[model samples]
Target: MIETANYTAYFDKARLAGRKLNLAPAVINAILEDVALAAIANTDRILAENQKDLDRMNPSDPKYDRLKLTAERIQAIANDIMDVARLDSPLGKVLMEDTRPNGLNLKKVRVPLGVVGVIYEARPNVTFDVFALCFKTGNVAILKGGSDADYSNRAIISVIHEVLLKHNIDVNAATLLPAEREATEALLNAREYVDVLIPRGSQGLINFVRNNSKVPVIETGAGIVHIFFDEFADLDKGIGIIFNSKTRRVSVCNALDCLLIHKSRLGDLEKITSRLLDKDVELFVDEESFKVIENHYPVHLLHKAEPEHFGTEFLAMKMAIKTVTNLEEALDHIAQYSSKHSEAIISENANNIERFLNEVDAAAVYANASTAFTDGAQFGLGAEIGISTQKLHARGPMGLEELTSYKWIVNGNGQTRDH
Candidate 1:
């Protein structure tokens, strides 16, 4: 764990190193391939490091699964990096060109956001994803992961640095800091070196960064996601999507947190929740939805929904259910509770679907689909740092292009403004 003073030195070195490299896609791709190979080849060692962190966590703890990096998850990271490698470079591209009447030629070209900083929770995959995306986009990365994944983050960063060393590239391009509040505080206000700060994890983490950081912040990944079961929904399709969204990977941010059902479509509630019930998903239902299935099995699993339950993001085998009178009510509920991350509506009615798509304020709005598709890889953007929830700079799954800023280059021969 490096202290703040040392981290500042590292950040300075990284910024200079990144500017010197002016990385091209070929070199970045080669480095990414080596990183992927190293991760796959050293799976045993990596898992061993991850185990040290996992052993300290309670099995019932929702974050326990998040902190544990298995073979499949590691492979997914490798595959994503490979995909990013194959994509075209995002930097130095000419976005727009303009010729002024006064003989000034102006062009807007994409450039790296310079040194990017990310402060995240126990998800170790972020270590590799951040490294890959930042390297590809030619932006240096400074990472500060949660203390729970200290061993895992260290191991991952070591592998990345090994790749850099092999390529004779500077390792500071992607450096990790100590998992402490001091480091975080230093990073938040390290506007001198860090070009931008992106916080990925719980709502609390995002809020903390937004309030404390002096550097520009990009808020991501606090999905109080919702799925609406409209009256026109195809029950078979709706059931599977809801079940998958809620149960596929409950520990992730994009997993469904709330379920809104139209009053007329309450007949098949049990059918949709059957899989969730099998997984022992607890249901906190509003008055209308509760009376419909109060007599069902697993009496302990059923509970009356409280005010807090509606707005909470349950990163576990739990969800809140509320009955809505119509599309307007459903839209209103989602507007009030959504973290502006991901929202979906299961309806075949064209008008209802269109309204939902056009009005929902989330970063992603899906019709007749699961909100789980709100991912960088899933959207064909390769590995994402996180789903940006804020409106400025970027929104939705942030990819290589989102990691860049544009600068206007003007060519003029003594052109002066006329008074």
Candidate 2:
């Protein structure tokens, strides 16, 4: 359980700050700009602290990649924050307005979600992203980062609180807890204070939050994303898409996990395998896909895919490959194994592209493109809190708008419920 002594005070202060922030989006923007500069000024300090965490883990661990924050990444983080500062306000905007039959003028207006609790594993960059996004949209954030990134998170959160204090904003607008399971559980169950909880990390973490949290949760990670190269796909173009999606940065949620190729394109599979080999990508190939390029590919990293491999999200330089006989088989395989984060199809045929786009159920479905574009920044939504896999109040790349809910506002002269 949380020690209300400190936790309650923080939430109360954050709630009040959230309400007050509704009238001060400009101040919020300035805070973001200042915070961005803070990161740049503290890059050496941030990376030094991050190195402490990294030294405790093996480079082979995927979490290591997620936890590492370098100078370039800090710069990128700062740039994205500035991008968020440039975005228009998301709160208090009228979604819709009209007059009802009883001559009552009604409108739906967006409102801040109050306090947002974010429980995430590794990735200290998320600390900056979540703060900038939540602050921009007027939602206070309580960040509980993973134990591995404890030092890194502390350094980052300290900077955030420092910036907030400088701007005379309540430090409670952003809070960081010691990374412990007990503390996470308390945060998960903080329904009385937190309006919403978002978990971004491994499947285990996401599942635990969903099963345990009394507060409403928005899931952000665990991507068993896939891409299909249909028979009609432009093979040269398809190869580039696959290479970029799978090899660009495998530690991300939007990175490709599986590759589905039409049986007719068996030769193209060899080319794709050979190209992946150059990037040192390990291939977990299905029986059919293995047979197609077993001896010809000449890559030691290649292995036959197991049942578990097909269902796995390889957040590394590893991926599963399946050869589908037809489009339906490819679609069925994706539907069966997808975490619904991002799925893509590379096809020149209009019908195949249209059907793939329409029939696939995912946060992002792409045509002749990589799944890498499934990001809040890439979608022109500034910095994203996370990509929601579940469909509820928010889905896909969660931007400032996702941190808001709407209420029905009624203008009535004389309204009666019984009327």
Candidate 3:
């Protein structure tokens, strides 16, 4: 088992190398291209290892569903690496440059965040995404993935390590924690080793990391996304967005969990609800929505939405249904209930769309589009480490640029402060 101190020493060395190399965007892209090719070439080995992991996993285990990797999944991971290779390098670029009246020049330049600690769960694809993003941005990353996907994650990490070694780069730039739960706990408390901790998975996991981690934490919320269909919303567009948002890959964090409709639109709610029911979606409807749909369909009726329901991240075919009096009410409901992850307004009215986009306090806000578009690939970010709901460091889909921080560079001729 690798100790936390050993991991910290590796990262410290990587950071020193990063500061010295000052890698250009083109060079970074080339390295990424090599990594992508390595992954693709080793696809067969990767999939075989992943299948072995799946076979050993218990089917009844809650995480079993998230641990399986298919051919399409592997291809998607390879494609994501290629896409990341094409993105602009996030290091050494000048963000701002100016000269003071006294001829002292100042520049704000992009720099790596040094060493980042990523704790994630149950998706082998994340192994690739994290490696590419951190490597491209010149940050050393320590990945502590879930035990369920340990085999797959290790296989992918091995391929990446090979690529780094082939390029004469230190393999320690990306380190994987030993497959042990206690190691993760120890790593979380190692603030001296880790600069920041980014956890991606269940709300429980994020909460655990936040509470126990001594390192700076960037909280990524469990998404409780919402879709508000205003009175003036085009029925066709509304149905399309809602269906796509809820049904197109329901297992993701950005999937819609609640649907809010204007009360005036209740007359047409039956049609929408019918379509959703046909797709096997369970509706947890509010009192008013229940009355309109109860006569035609069976639903889980509740008099009032509990605070827990409002903040619940139902990452499945279940959704909470509510009817608002007006756009204002809908906005208020969203502000109060949303997880600040993603929100959408399906309406033809420009004023309403503008208001929703401007006022919604979320990582991604959409108008006349499905909340599902709040993804890294959809937003042209190549690959994302995770979707950040936190406001301080990074928000929205976290790409290469989000993985970096900025520093000020000054050029002056031997001048003393305040003579």
Per-candidate TM equals 0.97, 0.96, 0.92
Q: Which candidate has the top score in lDDT?
A: 1
RMSD of each candidate relative to the true structure: 1.8, 1.7, 2.7
Candidate 3 lDDT score relative to the true structure:
0.83
Tens digits of per-residue lDDT for model 3 on 214-272?
Answer: 88998878889999999899999888889999988777888899899999999988888
Between candidates 1 and 3, which one is better according to lDDT? 1
Name the runs in model 1 displaced over 4 angstroms.
1-6, 414-419
Backbone clashes in model 2, listed as residue pairs: none
| Candidate that scores best on TM-score | 1
For model 1, name the residue pairs that clash: none
- Can you give the lDDT of residue 83 in candidate 1? 92
Q: List, residue by residue over 143-170, the lDDT tens digit for candidate 2.
A: 8998999999999999998998897887
Positional deviation of residue 38's Cα in model 1 after best superposition, in angstroms: 1.1
Task: Give the Å shift of residue 263 in candidate 1.
Answer: 0.7
Poorly placed runs, candidate 2 (over 4 Å): 1-6, 101-103, 413-419
